[model samples]
Target: MTCMRCGREADPPPRHRIGFPAPVKERILQSICAECWKEWEGVEVKVINEYRLSFLDPQHREMLQKACFDFLKLPEQA
Candidate 1:
């Protein structure tokens, strides 16, 4: 499928967590390509450190999620 972020035709993640939250999973399956997602992984770490985020905190996780999604150019869920 063509990736919404990269406009490349590539395979999706093999084990995408379908059970993940609706917005998260939908973006993965519908808009984000695997390569872009991997790139987002590194950026996500930087964001976490730059913001001094604790993964255990729900607010922190939410912030990270939005950042990662935005960096991947995954349009906001409607």
Candidate 2:
């Protein structure tokens, strides 16, 4: 199959693990090639929720901080 993103021809598709906790199974999974997966591994999600939370009346800053800390303490992959 051809990769939708890179237009490269791919070998028989291998199952991909992208979403955490629950895995997302793609049907037309040929959209991304192996090279795209390698590049995606380096992408980072920044903590930008603070700006949005500032508008809340109760100010969930403390709760949000604790959640962030707890998430960071999750077990690391071997």
Which predicted model would earn the best lDDT? 1
lDDT (Cα atoms) of all candidates against the true structure: 0.73, 0.41
Error of 1 at 18 (Å): 9.4
**What is the alpha-carbon RMSD of candidate 1 to the true structure?**
2.4
Candidate 2 least-lDDT 10 residues: 19-28
Which segments of model 1 are wrong by more than 4 Å? Answer: 14-22
Residues 1-78 of candidate 1: C-alpha lDDT, one tens digit per residue:
888888999866544533246667765877767787778767877997899998788898788778866787766665
Model 2, residue 5: C-alpha shift (Å):
0.7
Q: What is the overall TM-score of model 2 with all chains considered together?
A: 0.39
Candidate 2: global Cα-lDDT?
0.41
- Winner by TM-score: 1
Candidate 2, residue 55: how far the Cα is off, in Å:
24
lDDT of 2 by residue, 1-78 (tens): 766555789752346444322212242243556565544433312332434544143445444333333433322221
lDDT of 2 at 24: 22
